[model samples]
Target: MGLFDGYNIASSGMGAQRTRINIVSANIANAKTTHTEAGGPYKKQNVVFEELLVNNTKNLNNNLQETNNKNTSAELRGVGVKSIVENDADPIMKYEPSHPDANEEGYVAYPNINPVVEMVDLIEAMRSYEANVATFNTHKNIDSKTLEILKA
Candidate 1:
Protein backbone atom coordinates (compact mmCIF):
# COMPACT_ATOMS: atom_id res chain seq x y z
CA MET A 1 0.00 0.00 0.00
CA GLY A 2 1.16 3.54 -0.74
CA LEU A 3 0.96 6.62 1.46
CA PHE A 4 -1.86 8.11 -0.58
CA ASP A 5 -3.83 4.89 -0.57
CA GLY A 6 -5.35 5.85 2.77
CA TYR A 7 -6.72 9.07 1.30
CA ASN A 8 -8.14 7.23 -1.71
CA ILE A 9 -9.84 4.61 0.43
CA ALA A 10 -11.23 7.16 2.87
CA SER A 11 -12.60 9.34 0.10
CA SER A 12 -14.33 6.36 -1.44
CA GLY A 13 -15.90 5.45 1.89
CA MET A 14 -17.02 9.04 2.31
CA GLY A 15 -18.65 9.04 -1.09
CA ALA A 16 -20.48 5.80 -0.42
CA GLN A 17 -21.66 7.02 2.98
CA ARG A 18 -22.77 10.31 1.48
CA THR A 19 -24.88 8.42 -1.05
CA ARG A 20 -26.40 6.38 1.76
CA ILE A 21 -27.25 9.56 3.66
CA ASN A 22 -28.90 11.05 0.60
CA ILE A 23 -31.04 7.97 0.01
CA VAL A 24 -32.07 7.83 3.66
CA SER A 25 -32.99 11.49 3.62
CA ALA A 26 -35.09 11.00 0.53
CA ASN A 27 -36.85 8.03 2.05
CA ILE A 28 -37.64 9.97 5.22
CA ALA A 29 -38.82 12.99 3.28
CA ASN A 30 -41.27 10.92 1.26
CA ALA A 31 -42.41 8.62 4.02
CA LYS A 32 -45.86 10.18 4.24
CA THR A 33 -46.15 10.78 0.52
CA THR A 34 -49.21 8.86 -0.67
CA HIS A 35 -49.18 9.97 -4.27
CA THR A 36 -46.38 9.72 -6.78
CA GLU A 37 -46.29 9.90 -10.55
CA ALA A 38 -45.12 6.31 -10.58
CA GLY A 39 -48.31 5.30 -8.75
CA GLY A 40 -49.23 4.95 -5.09
CA PRO A 41 -46.72 5.65 -2.31
CA TYR A 42 -43.05 6.55 -2.50
CA LYS A 43 -40.57 3.71 -2.52
CA LYS A 44 -37.60 3.47 -0.18
CA GLN A 45 -34.17 3.79 -1.77
CA ASN A 46 -30.89 2.09 -0.82
CA VAL A 47 -27.32 2.43 -1.99
CA VAL A 48 -25.14 -0.35 -3.36
CA PHE A 49 -21.34 -0.41 -3.09
CA GLU A 50 -18.61 -2.16 -5.03
CA GLU A 51 -14.94 -2.65 -4.38
CA LEU A 52 -12.31 -1.00 -6.55
CA LEU A 53 -8.98 -2.65 -7.35
CA VAL A 54 -5.82 -1.01 -8.64
CA ASN A 55 -3.91 -2.74 -11.46
CA ASN A 56 -0.53 -1.60 -12.80
CA THR A 57 2.57 -3.24 -14.07
CA LYS A 58 5.54 -2.77 -11.71
CA ASN A 59 7.95 -4.05 -14.37
CA LEU A 60 7.34 -2.83 -17.93
CA ASN A 61 9.91 -4.25 -20.38
CA ASN A 62 10.26 -7.77 -19.03
CA ASN A 63 9.05 -11.13 -20.36
CA LEU A 64 5.34 -11.73 -19.92
CA GLN A 65 5.81 -14.53 -17.44
CA GLU A 66 8.52 -12.66 -15.49
CA THR A 67 6.44 -9.48 -15.44
CA ASN A 68 3.39 -11.30 -14.22
CA ASN A 69 5.36 -12.95 -11.45
CA LYS A 70 7.15 -9.74 -10.46
CA ASN A 71 4.12 -7.52 -10.38
CA THR A 72 2.65 -8.34 -6.99
CA SER A 73 1.25 -4.90 -6.24
CA ALA A 74 -2.37 -4.12 -5.53
CA GLU A 75 -4.20 -1.16 -4.03
CA LEU A 76 -7.74 -0.38 -3.02
CA ARG A 77 -8.81 2.57 -5.14
CA GLY A 78 -12.09 3.20 -3.34
CA VAL A 79 -15.73 2.21 -3.19
CA GLY A 80 -18.30 3.15 -5.78
CA VAL A 81 -22.06 3.33 -5.45
CA LYS A 82 -23.51 0.80 -7.85
CA SER A 83 -27.04 2.18 -7.77
CA ILE A 84 -29.83 3.57 -5.70
CA VAL A 85 -32.32 0.73 -5.79
CA GLU A 86 -35.94 1.18 -4.85
CA ASN A 87 -37.59 -1.26 -2.53
CA ASP A 88 -39.99 -3.48 -4.46
CA ALA A 89 -41.78 -4.48 -1.29
CA ASP A 90 -45.38 -3.48 -0.95
CA PRO A 91 -46.28 -0.27 0.87
CA ILE A 92 -48.01 -0.30 4.21
CA MET A 93 -51.72 0.40 4.01
CA LYS A 94 -53.43 2.51 6.62
CA TYR A 95 -57.12 2.82 7.29
CA GLU A 96 -57.60 6.53 6.77
CA PRO A 97 -61.09 6.99 5.51
CA SER A 98 -61.00 10.78 5.75
CA HIS A 99 -57.60 11.10 4.13
CA PRO A 100 -57.56 12.89 0.78
CA ASP A 101 -55.41 10.15 -0.75
CA ALA A 102 -57.58 7.35 0.49
CA ASN A 103 -58.69 4.78 -2.03
CA GLU A 104 -62.19 3.61 -2.76
CA GLU A 105 -61.75 0.98 -0.07
CA GLY A 106 -61.15 3.70 2.60
CA TYR A 107 -57.45 2.87 2.87
CA VAL A 108 -54.45 5.12 2.23
CA ALA A 109 -51.11 4.00 0.94
CA TYR A 110 -47.91 4.86 2.83
CA PRO A 111 -44.28 4.43 1.94
CA ASN A 112 -42.60 1.25 3.09
CA ILE A 113 -40.02 3.39 4.86
CA ASN A 114 -40.17 2.89 8.59
CA PRO A 115 -39.09 5.78 10.79
CA VAL A 116 -37.04 3.55 13.04
CA VAL A 117 -35.17 2.01 10.16
CA GLU A 118 -34.49 5.35 8.51
CA MET A 119 -33.21 6.83 11.74
CA VAL A 120 -30.90 3.88 12.29
CA ASP A 121 -29.56 4.09 8.79
CA LEU A 122 -28.99 7.81 9.17
CA ILE A 123 -26.99 7.26 12.33
CA GLU A 124 -24.87 4.62 10.68
CA ALA A 125 -24.25 6.84 7.68
CA MET A 126 -23.21 9.75 9.88
CA ARG A 127 -20.83 7.53 11.81
CA SER A 128 -19.30 6.18 8.65
CA TYR A 129 -18.86 9.68 7.31
CA GLU A 130 -17.13 10.71 10.50
CA ALA A 131 -14.84 7.71 10.34
CA ASN A 132 -13.84 8.61 6.82
CA VAL A 133 -13.11 12.19 7.82
CA ALA A 134 -10.95 10.99 10.67
CA THR A 135 -9.08 8.71 8.31
CA PHE A 136 -8.47 11.58 5.93
CA ASN A 137 -7.20 13.76 8.73
CA THR A 138 -4.83 11.02 9.85
CA HIS A 139 -3.42 10.70 6.38
CA LYS A 140 -2.97 14.42 6.11
CA ASN A 141 -1.07 14.46 9.38
CA ILE A 142 1.18 11.66 8.21
CA ASP A 143 1.91 13.50 4.97
CA SER A 144 2.71 16.72 6.83
CA LYS A 145 5.04 14.88 9.19
CA THR A 146 6.84 13.21 6.31
CA LEU A 147 7.39 16.56 4.62
CA GLU A 148 8.74 18.12 7.81
CA ILE A 149 11.13 15.21 8.26
CA LEU A 150 12.32 15.51 4.67
CA LYS A 151 13.15 19.21 5.20
CA ALA A 152 15.30 18.36 8.24
Candidate 2:
Protein backbone atom coordinates (compact mmCIF):
# COMPACT_ATOMS: atom_id res chain seq x y z
CA MET A 1 0.00 0.00 0.00
CA GLY A 2 1.12 3.51 -0.74
CA LEU A 3 1.97 5.87 2.08
CA PHE A 4 -1.29 7.79 1.72
CA ASP A 5 -3.52 4.76 1.22
CA GLY A 6 -4.02 4.39 4.95
CA TYR A 7 -5.11 7.99 5.22
CA ASN A 8 -7.54 7.57 2.34
CA ILE A 9 -9.04 4.44 3.84
CA ALA A 10 -9.34 6.02 7.30
CA SER A 11 -10.90 9.18 5.92
CA SER A 12 -13.44 7.13 3.99
CA GLY A 13 -14.29 5.22 7.13
CA MET A 14 -14.75 8.46 9.05
CA GLY A 15 -17.04 9.83 6.38
CA ALA A 16 -19.19 6.70 6.34
CA GLN A 17 -19.42 6.57 10.12
CA ARG A 18 -20.26 10.26 10.27
CA THR A 19 -23.12 9.64 7.89
CA ARG A 20 -24.31 6.75 10.03
CA ILE A 21 -24.19 8.92 13.15
CA ASN A 22 -26.24 11.59 11.45
CA ILE A 23 -28.86 9.08 10.40
CA VAL A 24 -29.05 7.68 13.90
CA SER A 25 -29.42 11.16 15.33
CA ALA A 26 -32.22 11.94 12.95
CA ASN A 27 -33.97 8.72 13.79
CA ILE A 28 -33.75 9.49 17.51
CA ALA A 29 -34.93 13.05 17.01
CA ASN A 30 -37.99 11.96 15.09
CA ALA A 31 -38.85 8.94 17.13
CA LYS A 32 -42.10 10.43 18.39
CA THR A 33 -42.91 12.31 15.23
CA THR A 34 -46.53 11.61 14.36
CA HIS A 35 -46.58 13.05 10.87
CA THR A 36 -44.40 14.30 8.10
CA GLU A 37 -44.82 16.10 4.79
CA ALA A 38 -44.91 12.68 3.20
CA GLY A 39 -48.31 12.12 4.88
CA GLY A 40 -47.27 9.70 7.56
CA PRO A 41 -45.13 9.30 10.63
CA TYR A 42 -41.45 10.01 10.23
CA LYS A 43 -39.66 6.92 8.93
CA LYS A 44 -36.40 5.96 10.56
CA GLN A 45 -33.45 6.40 8.23
CA ASN A 46 -30.37 4.20 7.80
CA VAL A 47 -27.06 4.66 6.08
CA VAL A 48 -25.95 2.06 3.57
CA PHE A 49 -22.21 1.63 3.19
CA GLU A 50 -20.44 0.32 0.10
CA GLU A 51 -16.88 -0.26 -1.00
CA LEU A 52 -15.25 2.49 -3.01
CA LEU A 53 -13.23 0.82 -5.76
CA VAL A 54 -10.06 2.00 -7.40
CA ASN A 55 -10.58 3.01 -11.03
CA ASN A 56 -7.47 1.24 -12.33
CA THR A 57 -8.36 -1.99 -14.12
CA LYS A 58 -5.18 -3.72 -13.05
CA ASN A 59 -5.72 -2.87 -9.42
CA LEU A 60 -9.33 -3.94 -9.65
CA ASN A 61 -8.42 -7.30 -11.17
CA ASN A 62 -5.68 -7.86 -8.66
CA ASN A 63 -7.97 -7.02 -5.80
CA LEU A 64 -10.56 -9.45 -7.11
CA GLN A 65 -7.96 -12.21 -7.54
CA GLU A 66 -6.60 -11.57 -4.08
CA THR A 67 -10.09 -11.87 -2.65
CA ASN A 68 -10.61 -15.14 -4.50
CA ASN A 69 -7.33 -16.41 -3.12
CA LYS A 70 -8.24 -15.30 0.41
CA ASN A 71 -5.24 -13.01 0.57
CA THR A 72 -5.07 -10.17 3.08
CA SER A 73 -2.60 -8.12 1.06
CA ALA A 74 -5.29 -6.65 -1.16
CA GLU A 75 -5.65 -3.09 0.02
CA LEU A 76 -9.20 -1.83 -0.19
CA ARG A 77 -9.75 1.44 -2.01
CA GLY A 78 -12.08 3.00 0.55
CA VAL A 79 -15.60 3.12 1.88
CA GLY A 80 -18.59 5.17 0.81
CA VAL A 81 -22.15 5.78 1.77
CA LYS A 82 -24.16 4.04 -0.93
CA SER A 83 -27.50 5.43 0.15
CA ILE A 84 -29.67 6.67 3.01
CA VAL A 85 -32.78 4.58 3.07
CA GLU A 86 -35.97 4.99 5.07
CA ASN A 87 -36.86 2.07 7.25
CA ASP A 88 -39.70 -0.06 5.94
CA ALA A 89 -40.67 -1.24 9.37
CA ASP A 90 -44.19 -0.47 10.40
CA PRO A 91 -44.76 2.52 12.61
CA ILE A 92 -45.51 1.95 16.30
CA MET A 93 -49.07 2.72 17.23
CA LYS A 94 -49.93 4.02 20.65
CA TYR A 95 -53.32 4.66 22.16
CA GLU A 96 -53.59 8.39 22.59
CA PRO A 97 -57.21 9.34 22.41
CA SER A 98 -56.73 13.05 22.97
CA HIS A 99 -53.62 13.43 20.85
CA PRO A 100 -53.99 15.73 17.87
CA ASP A 101 -52.56 13.22 15.38
CA ALA A 102 -54.56 10.26 16.63
CA ASN A 103 -56.60 8.28 14.17
CA GLU A 104 -60.32 7.67 14.53
CA GLU A 105 -59.46 4.58 16.52
CA GLY A 106 -57.63 6.77 19.02
CA TYR A 107 -54.25 5.44 18.00
CA VAL A 108 -51.32 7.66 17.12
CA ALA A 109 -48.69 6.34 14.78
CA TYR A 110 -45.17 7.07 15.96
CA PRO A 111 -42.02 6.60 14.01
CA ASN A 112 -40.68 3.06 14.06
CA ILE A 113 -37.61 4.03 16.05
CA ASN A 114 -36.41 2.86 19.41
CA PRO A 115 -34.38 5.33 21.38
CA VAL A 116 -32.19 2.65 22.95
CA VAL A 117 -31.47 1.08 19.61
CA GLU A 118 -30.70 4.44 18.04
CA MET A 119 -28.47 5.32 20.95
CA VAL A 120 -26.56 2.08 20.51
CA ASP A 121 -26.15 2.74 16.81
CA LEU A 122 -25.00 6.27 17.53
CA ILE A 123 -22.38 5.02 19.97
CA GLU A 124 -21.13 2.44 17.51
CA ALA A 125 -20.85 5.02 14.74
CA MET A 126 -19.07 7.43 17.05
CA ARG A 127 -16.57 4.78 18.13
CA SER A 128 -15.93 3.82 14.53
CA TYR A 129 -15.40 7.44 13.60
CA GLU A 130 -12.99 7.86 16.51
CA ALA A 131 -11.07 4.78 15.44
CA ASN A 132 -10.78 6.15 11.92
CA VAL A 133 -9.55 9.45 13.26
CA ALA A 134 -6.95 7.64 15.34
CA THR A 135 -5.85 5.70 12.28
CA PHE A 136 -5.54 8.91 10.24
CA ASN A 137 -3.52 10.59 12.99
CA THR A 138 -1.24 7.58 13.26
CA HIS A 139 -0.60 7.69 9.53
CA LYS A 140 0.14 11.39 9.68
CA ASN A 141 2.62 10.83 12.50
CA ILE A 142 4.33 8.05 10.57
CA ASP A 143 4.57 10.21 7.48
CA SER A 144 6.03 13.04 9.50
CA LYS A 145 8.62 10.72 11.06
CA THR A 146 9.55 9.37 7.63
CA LEU A 147 10.05 12.93 6.36
CA GLU A 148 12.23 13.73 9.39
CA ILE A 149 14.33 10.63 8.82
CA LEU A 150 14.78 11.48 5.17
CA LYS A 151 15.85 15.02 6.08
CA ALA A 152 18.47 13.72 8.54
Candidate 3:
Protein backbone atom coordinates (compact mmCIF):
# COMPACT_ATOMS: atom_id res chain seq x y z
CA MET A 1 0.00 0.00 0.00
CA GLY A 2 1.06 3.60 -0.61
CA LEU A 3 2.16 5.78 2.31
CA PHE A 4 -1.02 7.84 2.37
CA ASP A 5 -3.17 4.72 2.65
CA GLY A 6 -2.03 4.38 6.23
CA TYR A 7 -3.12 7.93 6.97
CA ASN A 8 -6.47 7.36 5.33
CA ILE A 9 -7.15 4.18 7.31
CA ALA A 10 -6.07 5.71 10.59
CA SER A 11 -8.13 8.85 9.98
CA SER A 12 -11.22 6.76 9.38
CA GLY A 13 -10.64 4.80 12.59
CA MET A 14 -10.11 8.03 14.54
CA GLY A 15 -13.32 9.51 13.23
CA ALA A 16 -15.38 6.43 14.06
CA GLN A 17 -13.98 6.12 17.57
CA ARG A 18 -14.46 9.83 18.20
CA THR A 19 -18.11 9.45 17.29
CA ARG A 20 -18.43 6.43 19.56
CA ILE A 21 -16.92 8.36 22.45
CA ASN A 22 -19.33 11.24 21.88
CA ILE A 23 -22.30 8.89 22.02
CA VAL A 24 -20.99 7.21 25.14
CA SER A 25 -20.59 10.61 26.78
CA ALA A 26 -24.13 11.53 25.90
CA ASN A 27 -25.45 8.25 27.26
CA ILE A 28 -23.59 8.70 30.54
CA ALA A 29 -24.71 12.29 30.88
CA ASN A 30 -28.35 11.26 30.53
CA ALA A 31 -28.23 8.11 32.65
CA LYS A 32 -30.41 9.64 35.37
CA THR A 33 -32.74 11.46 33.05
CA THR A 34 -36.34 10.64 33.87
CA HIS A 35 -38.01 12.95 31.44
CA THR A 36 -37.24 14.04 27.90
CA GLU A 37 -38.90 16.15 25.22
CA ALA A 38 -39.83 12.92 23.47
CA GLY A 39 -42.34 12.20 26.31
CA GLY A 40 -40.45 9.75 28.47
CA PRO A 41 -37.01 8.91 29.85
CA TYR A 42 -33.84 9.31 27.79
CA LYS A 43 -32.67 6.45 25.58
CA LYS A 44 -29.09 5.35 25.27
CA GLN A 45 -27.45 5.84 21.88
CA ASN A 46 -24.67 3.87 20.20
CA VAL A 47 -22.61 4.31 17.09
CA VAL A 48 -22.32 1.85 14.22
CA PHE A 49 -19.51 1.60 11.69
CA GLU A 50 -19.23 0.02 8.26
CA GLU A 51 -16.14 -1.11 6.39
CA LEU A 52 -15.41 0.34 2.95
CA LEU A 53 -13.72 -2.56 1.23
CA VAL A 54 -14.20 -3.12 -2.47
CA ASN A 55 -17.29 -5.23 -2.80
CA ASN A 56 -16.46 -6.55 -6.27
CA THR A 57 -13.68 -9.11 -6.30
CA LYS A 58 -14.04 -9.57 -10.04
CA ASN A 59 -13.11 -5.99 -10.72
CA LEU A 60 -10.01 -6.35 -8.58
CA ASN A 61 -9.02 -9.51 -10.41
CA ASN A 62 -9.47 -7.84 -13.79
CA ASN A 63 -7.39 -4.89 -12.69
CA LEU A 64 -4.63 -7.19 -11.53
CA GLN A 65 -4.54 -8.96 -14.93
CA GLU A 66 -4.15 -5.77 -16.93
CA THR A 67 -0.67 -5.27 -18.38
CA ASN A 68 1.61 -2.31 -17.62
CA ASN A 69 -0.78 -1.24 -14.88
CA LYS A 70 1.37 1.23 -12.98
CA ASN A 71 -1.61 3.11 -11.57
CA THR A 72 -3.29 0.14 -9.93
CA SER A 73 -3.03 0.28 -6.13
CA ALA A 74 -4.76 -0.85 -3.00
CA GLU A 75 -6.54 1.77 -0.98
CA LEU A 76 -8.61 2.11 2.13
CA ARG A 77 -11.91 3.76 1.22
CA GLY A 78 -12.43 5.01 4.78
CA VAL A 79 -15.26 4.17 7.15
CA GLY A 80 -18.74 5.58 7.69
CA VAL A 81 -21.03 5.61 10.71
CA LYS A 82 -24.15 3.61 9.90
CA SER A 83 -26.37 5.22 12.51
CA ILE A 84 -26.93 6.38 16.06
CA VAL A 85 -29.52 3.98 17.28
CA GLU A 86 -31.45 3.97 20.53
CA ASN A 87 -31.62 0.85 22.67
CA ASP A 88 -35.01 -0.86 22.49
CA ALA A 89 -34.77 -2.44 25.93
CA ASP A 90 -37.16 -1.23 28.56
CA PRO A 91 -36.12 1.58 30.87
CA ILE A 92 -35.46 0.93 34.55
CA MET A 93 -38.38 2.00 36.73
CA LYS A 94 -38.02 2.71 40.41
CA TYR A 95 -40.54 3.30 43.09
CA GLU A 96 -40.04 6.92 44.03
CA PRO A 97 -43.19 8.10 45.78
CA SER A 98 -42.08 11.70 46.26
CA HIS A 99 -40.59 12.13 42.79
CA PRO A 100 -42.35 14.67 40.62
CA ASP A 101 -42.65 12.37 37.58
CA ALA A 102 -43.82 9.38 39.53
CA ASN A 103 -46.87 7.64 38.10
CA GLU A 104 -49.96 6.54 39.98
CA GLU A 105 -48.10 3.33 40.91
CA GLY A 106 -45.26 5.40 42.44
CA TYR A 107 -42.90 4.24 39.70
CA VAL A 108 -40.54 6.69 38.03
CA ALA A 109 -38.92 5.60 34.79
CA TYR A 110 -35.24 6.24 34.26
CA PRO A 111 -32.91 5.65 31.36
CA ASN A 112 -31.67 2.10 30.80
CA ILE A 113 -28.09 3.30 30.61
CA ASN A 114 -25.50 1.86 32.98
CA PRO A 115 -23.05 4.58 33.90
CA VAL A 116 -20.22 2.14 34.63
CA VAL A 117 -20.64 0.38 31.32
CA GLU A 118 -20.76 3.72 29.54
CA MET A 119 -17.62 4.80 31.32
CA VAL A 120 -15.92 1.60 30.25
CA ASP A 121 -17.05 2.20 26.70
CA LEU A 122 -15.68 5.72 26.94
CA ILE A 123 -12.31 4.41 28.09
CA GLU A 124 -12.25 1.92 25.21
CA ALA A 125 -13.14 4.57 22.66
CA MET A 126 -10.52 6.92 24.06
CA ARG A 127 -7.88 4.19 23.85
CA SER A 128 -8.86 3.32 20.30
CA TYR A 129 -8.72 6.99 19.31
CA GLU A 130 -5.27 7.30 20.84
CA ALA A 131 -4.07 4.18 19.05
CA ASN A 132 -5.29 5.51 15.73
CA VAL A 133 -3.58 8.82 16.34
CA ALA A 134 -0.37 7.05 17.17
CA THR A 135 -0.64 4.99 13.99
CA PHE A 136 -1.19 8.13 11.90
CA ASN A 137 1.76 9.83 13.54
CA THR A 138 3.96 6.82 12.87
CA HIS A 139 2.96 6.81 9.24
CA LYS A 140 3.64 10.54 9.03
CA ASN A 141 7.07 10.13 10.55
CA ILE A 142 7.86 7.32 8.15
CA ASP A 143 6.75 9.42 5.21
CA SER A 144 8.89 12.30 6.38
CA LYS A 145 11.92 10.09 6.81
CA THR A 146 11.40 8.60 3.37
CA LEU A 147 11.21 12.08 1.85
CA GLU A 148 14.40 13.09 3.65
CA ILE A 149 16.18 9.99 2.40
CA LEU A 150 15.05 10.72 -1.11
CA LYS A 151 16.35 14.27 -0.81
CA ALA A 152 19.70 12.98 0.42
Q: What TM-score does candidate 1 get on C-alpha atoms?
A: 0.84
Question: TM-score for model 2?
Answer: 0.85
Q: Would you list the C-alpha lDDT of every candidate in the order shown?
A: 0.83, 0.85, 0.82
Candidate achieving the largest TM-score:
2
Top lDDT: which candidate number? 2
Clash pairs for candidate 2: none
What lDDT is reached at residue 141 by model 2?
95
**Candidate 2, superposed: residue stretches over 4 Å from native:** 54-75
lDDT of 1 by residue, 4-114 (tens): 778878987998899899999999999999999988889988897765542332323233454357565434456768678889989899999999999999999898888
- Per-model TM-score versus the true fold: 0.84, 0.85, 0.83
Could you give candidate 2's per-residue lDDT for residues 63-125 as a string of tens digits? Answer: 666666764555557778878998899988999999999999999999888899999999999
Residue-pair clashes per prediction, in order, are 0, 0, 0
Off by over 4 Å in 1: 54-72
Which lDDT tens digits does candidate 3 get at residues 64-144?
A: 544236676554455657689999979999999999989999999999988989999999999999999999999999899
**Candidate 3: global Cα-lDDT?**
0.82
The per-residue C-alpha lDDT of model 3 at residue 8 equals: 79
